[model samples]
Target: MKTKQEESATDFLKLVKNMKYFTKLKSDNSNGDLFNVTLKTASYNELNLMVSCLLKASICALKNDNSGYSSASESGIDVLLLLEMALQLLPDEEMQLLDEFHKNAIDRKAEQ
Candidate 1:
């Protein structure tokens, strides 16, 4: 029998999937491009850490190469330092605008 916490965690994972969070994932291992493939599945603990930490790291990308998020980290390369250099190349206003646009899009979806 599963404990209540276990059940809740499972449910939470389900919710994330239902919300399309898992729909946009790209393989870090490019087909024949990279020497090794880094197939990763976020563990429950890791997901908890990410959510609790408000990770803005874009280490992960969408399967369709559309949307992504990024965050700061201490290590030169870790789970959370994605697109930092590319993001730096972007203007602050553009970032802010993108944020606002995303919010609006989500709000519109929720309204529907």
Candidate 2:
């Protein structure tokens, strides 16, 4: 049996795998879908999937409302915070590698 944290992580991973696009529809001029997101990693994409899952989970928590004092909202936020902390445990070099990837990605886009 899996612990709550494990279950949460698993749920997040599943969500990320099933998600194909990300967009914020705001106006009639919107293109519906914005950026093309993909995850690549040395661990057969496991690391990418984990990071993507945490990011998506955090976003989901933010989208939940607390104005009505909903318990679910609190739970969602807690999950996000915990996952963020877990990610922080990654080695500094790993985080730096992630930063480099982002920088290279932007540079590639600039050439387009």
Candidate 3:
């Protein structure tokens, strides 16, 4: 049987997967029915998915509370930096796409 911590970790992973899927559906202008399809394409270690989830959670927290940025304020920034660092750990094409996606997200936020 799994320990409580392990169960919690599993639950967190499921939450992240669902959150990432929902955010992608919202941003892609695609049908919500495609949420599972998009999520199926994500690997457990996918940096893009992880970063996307982090961005979504951060934005949600910022909108719902007046706590300000807190120590977690730099999470999205840290995710971007980690993606850059992960370039050495991932394939060239994967890294290139992630860079492009990151740039597009930043551009979209700037426009907003």
TM-score of each: 0.26, 0.33, 0.24
Candidate lDDT (C-alpha), each: 0.53, 0.64, 0.60
Model 1: per-residue Cα lDDT over 1-112, one tens digit each: 9999999999999999788775444445546442432334367455445444433444233221333233223223354344433333334775688899999999999999
lDDT by residue (46-78, candidate 2, tens digit) is 765676777777656655544444554557467
Q: Write the per-residue lDDT of candidate 3 for residues 14-108, one digit (tens) a residue.
A: 99898874464443346645333233335636755665665666556555445664534444344444444444334568778989999999999
Sort by lDDT, best first: what order?
Answer: 2, 3, 1
Q: What stretches of model 3 exceed 4 Å from their correct place?
A: 1-89
Clash pairs (backbone) in predicted model 3: none
Stretches off by above 4 angstroms in model 2 are: 1-44, 66-80, 89-91, 95-112
